[model samples]
Target: MSKNLVIIGSGGDARETLEAVEAANQAGTADYKVLGFIVEARYGTPGALVSGLPILGDFDWFAGRAGEVVAVGAVGSPVLRYRLVERAARYNIEFGNVIHPGAVISSSVRLGWGVIVEAGCVLTSQVRLGDHTHVNLACSISHDTVLDDFATLSPGVHLAGRVRLGEGCFMGIGSVVIEGKQVGKWSVIGAGSVVIRDIPDRVTAVGVPTKIISSQPPANWITQSGEK
Candidate 1:
């Protein structure tokens, strides 16, 4: 029997994950039946349509559906994603992976729960992606790289071999990290930056050869309104 899945957002990312699940179902590679979404009630009314699927309820809706329905976060913000996962944990919610059919992932790669590998992504051998990592479209992660939990790789980013990304790091679109460098936890690499050296925690870096512009903490991934 197919496992019922609940996507935990109703935005574009949620739609993309839904498409990946549908593709997996069509390819007969994974047994998943998408039941609908769990949007924060402010987004829409319960039972209303999102990406052609009904909005089932909010974060608390999964409490009664344990074991019968699994969840995967479609939101991009690491902090918010972490918060949602923690909330779900109170009810013993189980999470699943949403890998796009167009993406290429090696058998040797280790993926954690609620991981989302979007379309056109190529993950090479020995890549260890941690729980709730969000890899956006057309990115390339080379061999032996480790991405810790809640890391977000924006579209068209490239990582050379042996790179290590700490927990909750965000690499903006078209960014490139060279071989063997480490990006510390909760750091944000701005768009199109080329990282050639190590970046410390809780700062925003940007430039051709990425430089630490300020020592400020990362912008709140979760806004007051709870949107990414």
Candidate 2:
């Protein structure tokens, strides 16, 4: 039997997640029947259509349906995604994951709940992806790479062997991290940057052999209203 699933977000990432679910279903790798999207009340209206799926309601939509449905966070921002996951967990919601059929993942890879590995992604042996992590289109994670909770890898990002991304880190599109590097929690690597060394927490780095361009406190990234 197929289980009911909902995506927590109604934006482009959510639609792309829906497509991954559909592809997984078609490939016979998953038996989930995606019901719709559920976002914050401020972001969506009930019955609105998104990529042909209904905007079921807000987080409150899970009030009586937690036992019957699973959810996956699809927000693009790592901090926002973490906030959404924590919010949904209050309803005792069980999180689901999406692995697009086009992704090639090693048998030794370990993935946590709510992780999304999109099309053309290649996760090599011993890779570990923590809860609510998002590996976007065409990203490549080499052997033993680890992505902590709510980490976001933009399209075409590449991580060399043994790299570790701390919680809520965001690697921008086309970014590259060399072997044995560590990106600290909530750090941001700008698009096309090449990280050759370790990055500290709550900083933004860019350039070839990336440089720390800016830094902020945790409160700046995670706000009470969940806005970045």
Candidate 3:
């Protein structure tokens, strides 16, 4: 029988996870098939099957499967994921990681559960991705970089070696982080910004050489560039 996998959550992270799964299936390296998805209570959209994968149930269904089902967290916010993980632990449910076929990750790289490395992403030697992290399209994460849980790299974002992104951070599209920079938790690096130093926590920053402009954080951070 083919390996069976189930994903939890149906938000943006879940959709991206589904897309990555399809990409892997297309490459013929997918060892498992998505059985269904389980969202939070009062959150699931019935028949909102992504790519034909049905919405099976809610958190209750996560532990509903016997030993065969591999549950994965596909949530974006670190705080949100932390809650999910904590709740899942009550059922003793473990999670799985999704690594896309097009991503070039070194053998030395270490990853925790529910970490999604998307298409065309590169993780050089000794890179570390914490649980539930999301590295999106075409981003380059150089050697020894570490991204904590719920940290997101938007499409085309580039990180030089030894960079450390704290939990729940968001790097906008086409942004560049120079070597050894440390980005704080819940921070946002705006689109097309160039980060050259340490960024503090819970702040919204942007610009050519990224500057912290506002004392209050934005609702979201995003960039839509197409290249390095």
> Could you say which candidate leads in TM-score?
2
Candidate 2 structure quality by residue, lDDT tens digits, 5-98: 9999999999999999999999999999999999888888899999998999988888977789999999999888888888899999999889
TM-scores across all candidates?
A: 0.93, 0.97, 0.84
Highest-scoring model, lDDT: 2
Off by over 4 Å in 2: 219-225
Clashing pairs in 2: none
lDDT for each of the candidates?
0.89, 0.93, 0.80
What's the lDDT for candidate 1?
Answer: 0.89
lDDT (Cα, tens digit) per residue for candidate 3, span 41-96: 68867677665788987666656555666767777655566667656656767677
Model 2 — which ten-residue stretch has the worst lDDT? 218-227
Instruction: Give the TM-score (vs. native) of candidate 1.
Output: 0.93
Candidate 1 error regions (>4 Å): 216-228
* Candidate 3 pairs with clashing backbones: none
